[model samples]
Target: MSTADDLKKLRLKAQIGITTVLGLVSIYILLTQPDNSSLQKWAIGTLGIIVGYWLK
Candidate 1:
């Protein structure tokens, strides 16, 4: 009902959406075992970045 509430809702939505998508990416990478290490690194790095950003 207020600007602060709106902002909180927006932040929550963005966080959830980004996290879910990145999580799926990590799952996909794990399921489809890429031969190149870079893909695996990307999956790990992305999830790490998300966790680091949100948890902080």
Candidate 2:
């Protein structure tokens, strides 16, 4: 494969890894502290950004 392909794959992997880790963190926080609306909103917002970047 080309260098471009490798770079693309690396970017995709990074994005997926970030999304997974953040998602897990959010789940833990939600389970442990359900009243923290700010953190939850932040998590959702970051995920939205990631999703938007992924879509773009």
Candidate 3:
């Protein structure tokens, strides 16, 4: 593969990793912080996933 192709693959992987981490963190907050607002977290997490999909 070309250098550009390799870079693109690396960037795609990073994006996926970041989105996954955001989703997991949101879930953790929702489960652990009962007093905190979960709706906001859910919205942020969903947005992250959506953005990632859009990027791909």
Candidate 4:
């Protein structure tokens, strides 16, 4: 594969890995939190995932 193609594949793999981990963390955070303010953490975690994927 060309260098560019390799880079693209690497980026896609990174995005999938990071987003999966972040999603799990978000769920854990939401589930463990007693107060309803966990929504903020969810929102932020989602945004982080989005930005991370987008930047890839």
In order of listing, the candidates' clash counts read 0, 0, 0, 0
* Candidate with best TM-score: 1
**True lDDT of residue 40, candidate 1:** 85
All candidates' TM-scores? 0.74, 0.65, 0.59, 0.62
Candidate that beats the other on lDDT, 3 or 4, i.e. the better one? 4
Q: Quickly count the clashes in candidate 2.
A: 0
lDDT of each: 0.86, 0.78, 0.74, 0.75
Task: Record all residue pairs in model 2 with backbone atoms less than 3 Å apart, i.e. clashing.
Answer: none
Model 4 misplaced regions, further than 4 Å: 38-56
- List model 3 lDDT by residue over 1-56, tens digit each: 57998999999899779877777776666667655476656756677776768777
Clashing pairs in 4: none
- For model 2, residues 1-56, the per-residue Cα lDDT tens digits are 56998999999899789888887887676667667589877766766876787788
State the local distance difference test value for candidate 2.
0.78
lDDT tens readout by residue for model 4, 1-56: 47998999998899779877777777777767766585756756686867776787
Tell me the spans in candidate 2 whose CA falls farther than 4 Å from its real position: 44-56
